[model samples]
Target: MLQGDSSAEGTQPPDIEWVFCESIVDAFPLLEEEDVAGIWMSRTSLPQTSEIRGMMQSGLMLRDMPEGVALLDADLRVIWANHRLLQWAGRPSGTPLGMTFYELLHNPEIMGPDFCPFHTALATGDESSSTLHSMDNQYFQVHAAPVRSAESPRNLIVTVGEITDEILQQQKLAAIHQAGRELADLRPNEIFMMEVDDRIDLLKDNIQHYLSDLLNFEVIEIRVLEQTTGDLIPLLSVGIDEEASDRRLSAHPRENGITGYVAASGVSYVCHDVQNDPLFIPGVADARSSLTVPLVLHDQVLGTINVESPDVAAFSDSDLQFLEIFARDIAFALNTLELLVAQKANTAQQSCDAIHSAVALPVDAILNDAVHVMEGYIGHSPEVMDRLRRILQNSRDIKRTI
Candidate 1:
């Protein structure tokens, strides 16, 4: 059979001639001819060409896609995958085919709100998604959807994209918030047992731990604003030079460095180049970048928290945001501590007043009785009179002490 119309007498010679062949053996001779453009397969011999064409269309659509894409059979075996998907799996084309999807990924742990995404998609004929944490510390967001076709085998189309950075950021944010909450956390026993200075030390230790371990901040300095004296009193310092920590900063935008400026303005500041920044006073040795944020609560600037790094432009906008949030929590914790201290002082004063009230009248009555007895006994018995005088003196002293 010819590929084009057979009406040779009526139609002008077709631009291209068609030659039909029964098999590859028949097409071999035609391929030897210089003018033969290409060989074509018969529709009957290649019945699955339409299906392959559909697959090719899908592959073409997905080839340049940013995310990883794969086709899986009912057995969860990979039947086909795009270049992106193969790259992610660290496999060359055709190697991953017939391998179970999990096996190809080296059995990534499914971190899921939907654990059985493939099963769910196939069973419900809907899309399902799950997160996968691979052995290589990479995180992937995987989505699966049933590929519905009446003539084709049951299959699933799965897409994956790396979400490692986003996941790690979320984890860090959560940890920072938890650490912030724990900064001022004290048990009732601790509150009663620990002195004000001891509580302050605990808070400092907690801040240092979180900043260094959780936030990965190396050089940190925290100062509380002494509202009365306008002094930024150093509350905590780590990896900061002693001289700088004790440099006596105040709420001045111009003269007192970045910490002071942030405290004064109640705004966050990022110093990309500490050497060139006018307001930056050296805190950490070899420091190249710095971030400072005001410890604010209820529209009031409580203090400032500053962090320094050795890499230029080390701090990003996200770092600034995280620091600011933590600073607010620090301010709140500090305020809570102050309130507790004030309440303790007030309680102690009340206790003293109660004791004075309870003892005052009794002591006054003793004084009155002692003096009266002393007056009556002075001329009668010298020893007894002396004893009475001592009693009267002791009662007056007791009243004064109370």
Candidate 2:
């Protein structure tokens, strides 16, 4: 076979595909060095451009006047631009034809600062939605559709639309109103509404006043409801007067009252009273007025925020309203932080359980062995009996748990 594969071009190898080759020995008998490459090419007939155009026209037609549509190449270079998008860009349809995204806009600031959704989607392969684009000097929302073919997945088509002017104006007005409320939060009463849902290890205290002072409480604090326990624990309070400041009241909160209510109900509680309110614990001094807000995310209560001041009726309706908004925002931020904390805790707990389980048996076995070993020496001492009794009792308790 190897002899037959020889030719003037050097060697013409046997067609190994005609027989099964299981190893280099089998291949060596059927193939030669010059026959390593076996290649052939042939021409095929294809339809002309006119026929392709007719096929395209027969298949589909634009049914609606969507705001804008564009096509892009594998490199995300704009290949074609529809009239609507050209108008949005303040240019003729063919103007952006040869230009890349960076060249077309003269600024490559992510999907948004200017080009937005399209830029964002291409960069992240993640869908983005924006109801308004403020950079074009004309308000509009844009969407991108990436067109990919089974044969070539990198090709793309992006379709964008300009939402009506009326909707854009409404969005702008809403922004202004929201900004006005955000601006009124002048106090450093930063409220960290965290979870009380079977997750807390330590409690917060004058930490609120300390934080308010730190964050400017004239702005924020972690709130807690002053409660023993029950429903409607609408308040989460934190903020310290000179007394509550000096005393970490919640180090171990005795149940039943406003603080407890906040923990139990997970509702944002507001009370202008600090010392005399039904939520305030008796014998606790220097607290004046208070506001307790729940830290909630995904309809679940994490914990409550309590803000307190030494002055009588310190919190006003504006304070209550603005703080509630802040509380809602804070809840989201806290939830993010909680994910990290919970992950770390779970890891540490797994480690601790592993260590405890490993050590518990060895420790008990060693203690028992020590008692047996001492029986011949220290066992004679009268005091050893009492010591062994105490150790044995403790060991029994430890063993029961393990």
Candidate 3:
């Protein structure tokens, strides 16, 4: 303990201290006449580290924050981080001190090499906001604002809120709507199967270009069951090559793979970790995760749609749900086309049968009566009778030719 004596002019303050003071001048009623400036003063010490931490936390209002909040120095190193921020970083004990924000987040690619949002805010004193995405498809909405205090230098206050669920929902809705538009272009007729095949090829191409581009999925395959054989056949594939991988269009029995299981059971299956999944099939090389959704309608399994990623737990529950719903739309479209095609084929066969019956009966009777009349007029010469017999035989065989 030390006294803050007015007479001690040259004494320097210690490097750090937790100071507490109370004014007692008003309490000194007995010393009203005497000068109070000469009164003695004393200082008592408290735990400096805990006291400082408490003051910092209280000033920043960091307790119980839902969004991640952090006070960053000019170098982007973490000076102070709130409880929520620490928890998001998996540092509940307040570790990760003095580390740069991007370093701690392990995602430097979210911003460019020369661009740091926190540094820009501190330098320009202007607030900035942007969206960032992690490799695991999690999204964060980031806001960086400049904070200035008379007692301290300028720092950046960075706040981050997770927006993965909201953004994904919007994206899924948009994608489903777009797919609906594309599928509406199909015209069902005698050539409906041909058009369906062509449209599926186009759909697969767009998926490889845009759908796989956004989701970062390495593999996409669509399968449709052959109505005759009841076997699943690959309609289109983006990543898996039939020749190179030695994979065929048809999936093996349920004991052979995940797709088969989904197809047979008429349900969706997700393997967040392929290495650990007992039913996971090793069709794609180095596949760490997979999602298989069956195309089903009226309690009948049509086929399966599959997607694969190289990272474990790369897909979320929303992904599986969205895909399962999308598969329903596809299944309905295919089933409708198949029914139309079958009806058209049946109608064409009925028309051909009607034509054959209408032409064969009258023609056969005319030929037989003409042959009998010719035999009576020509007196049944050996050569003429043979010709008449041959004409009758040919008339009877006309139906087989038709």
Task: Please give each candidate's TM-score.
Answer: 0.83, 0.29, 0.53
Q: Candidate 1: lDDT of 339?
A: 83
lDDT of 2: 0.51
Q: How many residue pairs clash in each candidate?
A: 0, 54, 0
lDDT (10s digit) by residue, model 2, range 1-402: 222232222233443433333332334333454654432111221223344365556333321245666666756677766666666677754573767643554442343544465556666665555544435545455456555445445545666656556564455445434543443332222323333442222222223333353223442335332334323322223323434333333312345445556655666566666545656753235546666666666776555556666677877665565555555655554455456456667866998788789979887896887678567656377777777767877877766665
Stretches of candidate 1 off by over 4 Å are 1-61, 93-96, 148-153, 379-382
Over 4 Å off, model 3: 1-59, 62-165, 189-218, 225-230, 241-254, 377-394
Error (Å) of candidate 3 at residue 208 is 6.5
Off by over 4 Å in 2: 1-255, 282-284, 344-402
lDDT of 1 by residue, 1-402 (tens): 223324442354558677765545445556667999876554455654555477668668898788998889999999888888788778886673798999888899999989999999988999999999999899999999988665344799899999999999898899888988788576546675578998888788878888888788988999999989889999998889999988999998989998889888998999999888999988877999999999989998899999999999999988987888788789988998898888788988999899999999998888888877777776697889888878888888888887
Q: Decide which is better by TM-score, 1 or 2.
A: 1
Tens digits of per-residue lDDT, candidate 3, 218-327, equal 68877887767766777767776465234443445546478777877777888999989888767678789989988888988888888888889878887787777667
Error of 1 at 112 (Å): 2.1
Model 1, residue 402: distance off in Å is 2.2
Candidate 3 backbone collisions, by pair: none
Give the local distance difference test score of model 3.
0.68
lDDT of 1: 0.84
On lDDT, the stronger of 1 and 2 is 1
